[model samples]
Target: MHHISNPSILYFGTPVVLVGTTNSDQTYNLAPISSAFWLGYRCMIGIAAHSKTTENILRSGECVLNLPSVDQVEAVDRLALLTGTSPVPAGKLAKGYSYEADKFKKAGVTPLESNLVKAPRVLECPVHLEARFVSIHPLGAETGIDQIRSVALELKVVRVHLAGSILSDANPDHVDPNKWKPLIMSFQHFYGLGSQLQPAKLASVPERLYRTFDTESAKATH
Candidate 1:
């Protein structure tokens, strides 16, 4: 049975990413967003036109996508209603948004230097991707709303930084599913991965790697 109810937001569920962009003052601005997706080496992020992140990315042409673990949800949430824009827009103001020039300080996250981009990566995040802005496309206006518009930014990944704890010893390029847990946003709420139900039949993980993981699990249990 399906219920057809119009929901105010369509964020069903998505991995939360902290977008790092350089401000006009050459300072880094960190913003939390979930409307991002990746395909191949290119990633697309949807951001409001009035956001400082969008403006910075357009001018600087580079940014970092920092993937925080479930444990960092509180830090991410602290940045939810804070905007880097000095003059907070009326729409955002009405929604309880405030201006925070120093987002890194407010969120209590350390900024780490990146090799290929000007934007710094969040030191607390497990994964960091240095990317160069490719293009920005204006999205169609919302239903019956001519004043509101959004833009989708396409970025090409230039470098990827992964925490050693999340990397597989068997395959340096593969992230261990057992160790990597991403923070997910579901309809404005935060959630983490539940217990694994079963192994995928067509999993890319090699049999030997699975055996090693299973052996480690058994050893820990004993």
Candidate 2:
């Protein structure tokens, strides 16, 4: 028998992504999100109302999804907690702190140049996705004014970066799913991936090569 959990709000293993956007003033806004995914090479992101991310995409039509790891999990959590519109001069997010134009500095994340997008990639993260906003859907929330139904970002995979330790040239199949540990939210709680049980044809990395990777993707759809 299975017990029914509350549906009021549910948080599951959603990968934490640093959404890189540029404001109307040409200023950069980085919003940390876990509501992002990929279809083959296409990427999609979910954003709330009147957010800098939404505005930036509306104006510039481009963005970057910077993947994070367990070591940066605290920083990722911080970005989710602190509201970007808050009146505080500079505040704390979670593991990372906030600043007017120095989020990268506060979070201790490195920024690398991108070939197709204006926003830079997070050097620390194992994967980076450059995307273009293709469609938007508005969702009605029971409590909030209105939530983002879902935004589909169609992206042409321009580049993919991986850590040296995770990349195995000798064994092209050396790519392991567990290597890129992402933070996923479920029922308002955060959970780390468990492990990679099976290796797919795309890569033949052993299941035990990475600890955190296996922990998270142990039973995930991706």
Which lDDT value does model 1 have at 2?
100
Taking all chains together, each candidate's TM-score versus the true structure is: 0.87, 0.70
lDDT of 1 by residue, 44-153 (tens): 99889779999999899999999999989989999999999978899899999999999999999999998878998999999998888999877875554566568889
- Which candidate comes out best when scored by lDDT? 1
Q: Ten-residue segment with the worst summed lDDT in candidate 1?
A: 213-222
> What is the overall TM-score of model 1 with all chains considered together?
0.87
Model 1 misplaced regions, further than 4 Å? 141-148, 204-222
Candidate 2 lDDT score at position 100: 49
Q: Per-residue alpha-carbon lDDT of model 2 for 5-116, expressed as tens digits?
A: 7766555567777877766666566778777677544566766645556767777878778877677776666565444444432323443534345566656777787667
Q: Give me the displacement of residue 209 in model 1, in angstroms.
A: 18
Q: lDDT for model 2, on a 0 to 1 scale?
A: 0.63
lDDT of residue 146 for candidate 2: 49
